[model samples]
Target: MLMNSNYKVAFFDVDGTLADNELPRELGIYGRIPESAKRALSKLKEAGIEPVIASGRNYEKIADFAELLGVDSVISSNGTYVTFQGEPVANHYLSTELVKEMVEQFQTKQTDFLLETPEEILEYAADELLPENILQFLCHCPKEDLPSLDTEKLIAEKVAPTALNIHYKHVSKASGVEEILQKMGISSDQALAFGDEENDFAMFEKVGFPIAMGNGNDELKAKASYVTDTVKNHGIWKACLELELFEEE
Candidate 1:
């Protein structure tokens, strides 16, 4: 059953939307939500809007951010997983064949990466590209502290992967978003999303309103419904306010 316009949901991207990109790169470590952004989120909730933190991070990691924002529902792992109030709403594991293929491909390309199962994040070819600070923040380990896993052994044990992430190449976040919407008894047209990256394009196709941050990639900005200020500049809040997401208090 599709509810009309009065029922609305807002999906937020983590790194560039709510939290600053915590990953260390030349991009540096983006910090927590600024005061103004926090205020905006609070105002949105007060207006009876359902605010959801949607990101590529794992279910456990992003749960904390959802707590900070006081949002109970989240679509994590680029939509490969979702949860609400500590209950599993949906879970999508990569096909075993696909997992093996990705591992083989990453090895061939010598790319730095990790794999996430429902339980742990396994590091492989891990180097400076997967920084300690970010690992500590996301998985509670210093990069040096991570343990190596035997992918071959895991295959023998028939282990399942919750999701696959690489330095480059894979399906878009949109695929996960669509799967989640279908599982949740909702349609893409019922939701709005904010994101900033090449990875976010597929999701934009299914959403009712796609907002690109001012700092988003050029291609994403070109496809967005509106290009707003940078995340650091409180672009999301400004755009939401302009869109009447909240009645100005």
Candidate 2:
């Protein structure tokens, strides 16, 4: 199962991929990054593969995680924002109409939600609106209660909600990956990506090697080039090892 050594970059999803989806005891904190994951990242760097965090989480929320992982590149807010080498690459925002509509819906339905701005996450209704398993940028409302925004309209405007239900326009993890690839002068086939949720579909589609965690969604696994063990079992390390992305010491 050895792969080509041409992989120049590796995009990693946060929850359920690099880290467990469980929340820490501290409020608004994400799960800890495993030591094995850290070692896997180090190996990638040693192999000349640039590691990047590609997550649906907002930039502010994922900043600490990126620092902890020692990664300078990030595709955050489901690709609405991206950075490379600690420099801003691109930033897309939700349309004004879309924002107004969402705010109205949230107010009407009394749904608890948080609005993610460039500066900070603004609490709309109350704290803890997001589930413990998920991050803070999402809302806890039911599908039926969600705003009936026209799908065709969104497509027409190039606006859409991510798999995590966060609304943004004209961007996805795929687009973010493309941005970084263009900037780094690397082709899509020269990249690898790891993911466990539907939000990662775009990233998988963009990368040459898409590895899904064992605990990942069924559809994602079906589409993956390889499926490894769960995060708790050091899936990233195992997959990289099996693919011979880096030599074992």
Candidate 3:
């Protein structure tokens, strides 16, 4: 499949899309992007394509990776927050009342939980019930950084008004993508999106072209306009080449 190189904006997911899903180890099917892929992204940058990172992580963590990619804007913690350059564009937090209710409900159900602040990710570990499989999949950060929190204390602490996340259900990557567009004064129709998981489904629905990684979920592949090769094979580079988005300077 081919994309319109005329797009003014581009949104990319970090895991399983741009970066290797098996981060920390960088050994997944689409491990770190290849040099060729990096060149292609650079070409897009040179063309004045406004690249945005849409992720379900906190702002600070996403910023670290964005700096490496030369990206200055990010949509983090789903659509709950957006940052342009180093300044915040928009930020949303779960209402204190909403948090109180959800926290009590989660305690009753014993569901593991996480709260994303602009600066940090806080996990509520009830006897370390976090499944190792999920942990392995999110190995981008150090184990020490995965701080355990006392839910009661978290509720007692006054949440700053500017915080961006208070997730109850799974984080919504779609919201992040939408936030980026809203901040950029563009529409999803003006962008190309790349994703690989269920969280990415909502985002794909709004874009003109949605590209899925070869190793992505079946549903995502079914909905995408194009499916690139596995991440490790320079899938992004290959797709850009095929789509004529990577012409040599």
Best by lDDT: 2
Task: Estimate, for each residue in 120-221, the C-alpha lDDT of model 2 and write its tens digit.
Answer: 666764343432222123565555655666564332112234223555445678899999999899898999999998868878999898999999999999
What lDDT does the true structure give each of the candidates?
0.61, 0.77, 0.64
State each model's C-alpha RMSD to the native.
9.2, 5.8, 9.2
Which prediction has the highest TM-score against the true structure?
2
Q: What does candidate 3's lDDT look like per residue over 106-220, in tens digits?
A: 5665545555566665665546533211210112233233233334432221122322223433235566666667777877777888888776888898788888989899999
Prediction 3 TM-score vs. true = 0.71
Residue 212 lDDT (model 1)? 93
What C-alpha lDDT, on a 0 to 100 scale, does residue 183 get in candidate 2?
A: 89
Backbone clashes in candidate 3 total: 5
What root-mean-square deviation over C-alphas does model 1 reach?
Answer: 9.2
Q: In model 3, what is the error at residue 33, expressed in angstroms? A: 3.6
Selected candidate, larger lDDT, 2 vs 3: 2
Give the clashing pairs for model 2: none
Candidate 2: segments with Cα more than 4 A from true spot: 22-31, 104-112, 124-138, 148-150, 153-164
Instruction: Report the error of model 1 at residue 100, Å.
Output: 7.4
